[model samples]
Target: MTDRQWADWHRPQQHYLIEPRYLAGGGDIRHATEFLRASGWKDRSKTGGPLVFHNPDKLVRVVFDPLAQPGGWTVEGRATADRPSWEARFGTGTPVEIIAGLTDALTQQPTAHAPNVWAPLGTHGWEARRGQHVTAVSPDKSAFVQFHQSSPGQAHWWIGARTEHGRAWDAHLSPTTPLSLVQALTTALSDPRPVMRPLGNVPPSDRIRSTSVSVTPAQLGAWQQARLTAARTAMWARSAWTAARPRNRHPATAAPRVPAGHTTGRR
Candidate 1:
């Protein structure tokens, strides 16, 4: 991390994921890293396979554009150019349970955005890591969430949410450490430009109440009377005005616009 005085990073941050498939007896760690990297995550420890690949920047790239191999996800570019972001998408399951799994494994406080939108951490792509790493067991009804980066002139990723599907996320790669990814992220996160905004619609404020409509019987009677009076007056003037009014089929309607340097009808 850049250690710049002006840099912005959330202190004491902790993030975690829970994959039941990872904890199985036949589980492979390298296979996991491969799947995650393709989307954009990388590991520094080089701990074989799907051990622990943490880093906000790398995680974002992998999340959006994951390199899907036959087995697991792989690490590729740190979704820096693409506004990198992460989304904890669930597949028809309990969000609280999913978050609970991550919290239990990582020993951190896990919150939710809605049903699938989990709690957020870090500024740009920085994640606060703590607690011991554990394997995740993928459920039968797989809850495949993703962390992706957004494209340029498209700041939607930083503000909105992202989703991942079947084969799209299961890509893999050779066992590689995400060291550089973390380093890059640390530098980026140090000097933060945090913009606090709501995920979707900025919910209406509690202080603002819809104004009461004025629909008294007297008002309705008065309005109807006014309308009748105006209609009678317009009926009397309609015939006189219609005599001189131009028709919709007039020749001028089909005329082309004159060129900038030229004159028209006078010639």
Candidate 2:
């Protein structure tokens, strides 16, 4: 291992290795082996390309790969022996203490963020708003998510995500979604990947057939004015066109209308 990789390996915190780090090919494997031995993590495999470290309980497994470059050391553990396993990766030479800390944390139940679950929206650069319910827009303003206290089909809190590009997806979720997961999802939303959602309630055609629009007196007056203006414009255009055209000696007869309250002059 190089001086920098060795320095990274002895660090106090695990933050540096959360993402992949490239390690030079030579001597890293021996360095990792010696470090794993000092940390009391046993080599699970007698023969292997990657060194696997396991605690006495075997609940946590940390894999150190000298060749894992372009990828970091991976730590896998379960909340309990019966619980599902979760994995995280670190850079080339992550400190053993940091990996152990993460392994311990993974074995515990997730912390729930409730009631004030949406409070972190602002921290992620999302603008919070109140419409029929509550909503928040992403930092870049490319996407938005709304939380409804209650809606026609849903009685509990449901949220929807939408983008300016006509992509819309929503889900019904309890307020207990883990704060960490929520943060991760919001971060992912900034990427180009689309969020998937299920179809929501659709009204039957019969119900839509009964729907009607109501127009007020003001609207009626506006409609009448628009029709009158169009009629006058059309009349003027016709007259102008006729005057510009050649006229014949014979005149055509036209019908005349009587006034509303008066008879025609010739009955």
Candidate 3:
């Protein structure tokens, strides 16, 4: 391992769950690892294809900056122009500047991790509004805003916090945070720069994180085989269960238990 990698190895971290699709372009593990490696971050886990990066001791936090807004998402200009206004009015400053200043605090890695990988914020013909949910005119729009993979389906920025960097102790949980505010904005025309979220609930900063690990051939095969076996076993069991039952009987009618509330015919 390189010096930078060693440094990153010693740091503390939070956990996050990232979508495979989000990690496709800029958010991918290879790209994030390259960036993390130059600055002393290391991939600690054995599971590959994840966005997990570890630091020596909370020395640095990898922030996921989405340069472009996905379809349906909006970025307020005046609010977003400088640093996000929340940092200013709220007195922190924009994430860009925050990360920039923190850069001097630790070793800044030089790799191809760019915001361009994340699609830039866009209005997509809808009027951009500040602090409000964007109006989705079409129920099934081709252009999908930022999507985060959840248990059942692909969700919006609210699910972005899943990409956390940390240990594999908890299976897939960690104590991490977001480097930038990649939240949803109003879909109206006259939006503000702050790009304040208007929804009642928002994805918390502590949620977004990266936890990348190196994968091995044997492990991958084992995992695949396990899943396949489980699936095949379940299918076979289901087939057997159904086949063993009477074909003509109604499924709702279970086998009768001993008769109750009956009087013997003979006295």
Candidate 4:
């Protein structure tokens, strides 16, 4: 095996070691879904269908379906039942981390200085144009974002990263999709910082578009050792805290636990 591949084999699964990349591949959806649950979104999914979540005010809804086509995950915000406000859709291949960017924005209050989607791309030497439609392309011409009118009164937005082999990831947004969400997506896309990844694990297509930076074995070892030491120290501290905590002499009766099972619910 190659030296870099050897290092990847030895690296711990949870280690912080990473390489920067313009577009990272697909990631687990749990992160985004968990974030929504923690952020006060109510789960309203049915047993045999897609996972659905709604904000407390019921004005926003998120749906995730592993089997859905074109877009497996969708988010929609509406002012009323009859009148829709905005919508965003993410293909199955889109990374959860990217999806979280939009979800995070949804939960927070809007800022005065919203992020500029086109400015950053232009600053990074990406081509940007405005006229009948707004569009931007990465310096390498492998990634792009476009906004245009699909039809009268209907707007469409698309963002995608790809290589010669195939598409890396992409997202679609409707006319009313919040500008903040669009900015969140563009911010991530235009970030100068690279995403770390094991050289051996990277797909061949991605390697063609990426600029690899070699990290010495010594540096990798040092980073791993530091993480191990920190983890052990944290564990020891936790153990000590647990041992020192006082235990109740007489514990109260625990409430009956509900059996785990799926329940049917309306979306």
**Which prediction has the highest TM-score against the true structure?**
4
Top lDDT prediction, candidate number = 4
> On a 0 to 100 scale, what is the lDDT of residue 234 in model 3?
47
Instruction: Candidate 2: list runs displaced more than 4 Å.
Output: 1-40, 45-48, 68-70, 78-82, 91-267
The pairs that clash in candidate 4 are 18-196, 19-195, 19-196, 19-197, 20-194, 20-195, 21-195
Better of 1 and 2 by lDDT: 2
Q: TM-scores of all models?
A: 0.16, 0.26, 0.23, 0.64
Q: lDDT tens digits, residues 123-233, model 2? A: 544566555555565554434545455656442233333333332333333333333333333333333322111122111122111212333434444654564454445
Could you tell which candidate, 2 or 4, scores higher by TM-score? 4
Q: Which model, 1 or 4, shows the larger lDDT?
A: 4
lDDT of 3 at 81: 24
What is the per-residue lDDT of model 1 for residues 24-129, given as tens digits with 9 covering 90 to 100?
Answer: 1112222223333332334454334333455323332222111223322222333333223223321111222222232122111112211111111222222222
Local distance difference test, per candidate?
Answer: 0.25, 0.39, 0.27, 0.63
Worst 10 residues of 3 by lDDT: 168-177
